[model samples]
Target: MRYLWYLLPWQFSPAVLTVCVLTVALYLRGLLMLKRNGAPVGFWRPFVFFLGLAVSYAVLQTYFDFLAQHSFWVHCLQQLILHHLGPALIVLSGPVLVLREGLPRAGRTGAPRVLREMRLDWLRKPLRLAWRTLQHPLIAPLLFVGLIFFWLIPRVHFATMIDTRRYLLMNWSMFADGLLFWWVILAPKEEQGSAAVGYKVRLLILPFISMTQIVIGAYISLVPWQLYPIYALCGRALAISPMLDQQIGGLLTWIPGAMMSLVGVIVVLRHMMREEEAQLRMSPLRAETPGSSRPSAEVA
Candidate 1:
């Protein structure tokens, strides 16, 4: 019973619960529909997606949130889930594909018609245009890196921790931006239209952002002074000294955060390799190995 109590929300939000439940129900429905059609709806993707969603929710609603508020390192760990690991896992699961089909037929087909009838059709183009602009390769990398620095500013970080509204807003922005950034980095180019960024561009962006994290992290970890004094004010959950807490937080920001970038690069490279293999398989003439004496052969 004590263990079960820890699973409950520390400060329950009906809106968060509704969104999470709705998505789970919709995803399950979509899975059933796909299975009925003999589409290959595998086990792992849905599992990963749910796990990702659960992690984000856990940090916010579980006893973890209480610990996070009182400890700088725990807070950084919470941010990592909300901003990196959770969103990356969610995107990798292909939720967009399932969620689209999960919608009712009327909702899918009649949405445009209803919008037109309501004289809100003009909103569609502008929304799409805005999305494209935001997802632009250059802009995306900037925003992804910039947001981290923005929130890390000692003053801003202090205010965000103390104020409930700002705290909620900060969490929301982190999750949303994370989704957008990871989708750009990981989504297969073959399935994408204009949203597909070049592999080279994504590769470049990941390293740059990772380096930025390392720089900031090293500074924080090595600095003699306490960068964020809010934990001291609020009283730390852990018994460690303030410097130790700050150093641990800096290491978390340095290591796992940059690790996400490394993982993103590997995913991108795999996508590139798969696409190349596909092209080679489809083409009759193939490039011969440099060391092989045999000439290029026709593929079956």
Candidate 2:
């Protein structure tokens, strides 16, 4: 009974717990400041903090369960959640303005020395040259669909076939890439630019991207298949029961990930619309005032 602390994976890694606690504490402190001092909870702060907490919980839970016994399906579930859902949330959580004020002044510095030395011109050339090529309307949908199949590859799914460490790294890297790629099209204008297409246009595009996962999952679920054979022995040895586990994993990936991502797109679009409306309302008042745009209530 005294050793109950062992039940928590966060206890095993003080660093992970430390980061999670600090992040939540910062958000809570910001919330208190907003309540008391009329501070704004910057656009992305709430979402970023939410993402951090969710990822931390998912990672810790997976780590501890793995330590208890290596179940192939459990590992797959963890990877899918960490890479597919978690990192996407993390990226969407970005451009946090509330957290901006909380950060020390040092972090606000622009263009580090390392960045200055990096030859960005060469890298930026192709992106500029073939902006249209890079802007293929199908790229985002393909990435989302490709991710569904890529993970199911027997080599990737099988833990023993590849180095577990490398697999984890690849999963995280791919997740990050997916987030960045989609963001190029779906990203909010407040953080980037107000393009020819408005937030409403982006809202329409989001459904197409989100549905890719659902279609892939439904196909896999209905088909007769064994996508990850290497895991068969491991699952049997570790009592994972692959068929049942795979079905659940597919459902988990298909349902929550797509739904959450669509929700994020909707939230961002709403935020953009609200900001635009506020600006429009303020514009007329600013124009009417001839002198400085400050409120005039001077009685001495």
What C-alpha lDDT do the candidate models reach, one value each? 0.85, 0.54
Query: What's the CA error at residue 172 for candidate 2, in Å?
Result: 1.7
Residue ranges of candidate 1 with Cα displaced over 4 Å: 110-118, 286-300
Candidate 1, position 64, lDDT: 90
Query: Can you write out model 1's per-residue Cα lDDT over 108-144, one digit (the tens) per residue?
Result: 5654676786789998788778788778998887888
lDDT of 1 at 164: 88
Model 1 C-alpha RMSD to native: 4.6
The worst-scoring run of ten residues by lDDT in candidate 2 lies at: 291-300
Pairs that collide, model 1: none
| TM-scores for every predicted model | 0.91, 0.62
Q: Per-residue lDDT for 274 in model 2? A: 66
Tell how far residue 160 is off in model 1, in angstroms.
0.8
lDDT of the structure predicted as candidate 2: 0.54
TM-score of 1: 0.91
lDDT per residue, candidate 2, 262-300, as tens digits?
Answer: 675766677666654665576757646556452221100
Q: What is the lDDT of candidate 1?
A: 0.85
Q: What lDDT score is found at residue 257 in candidate 2?
A: 51
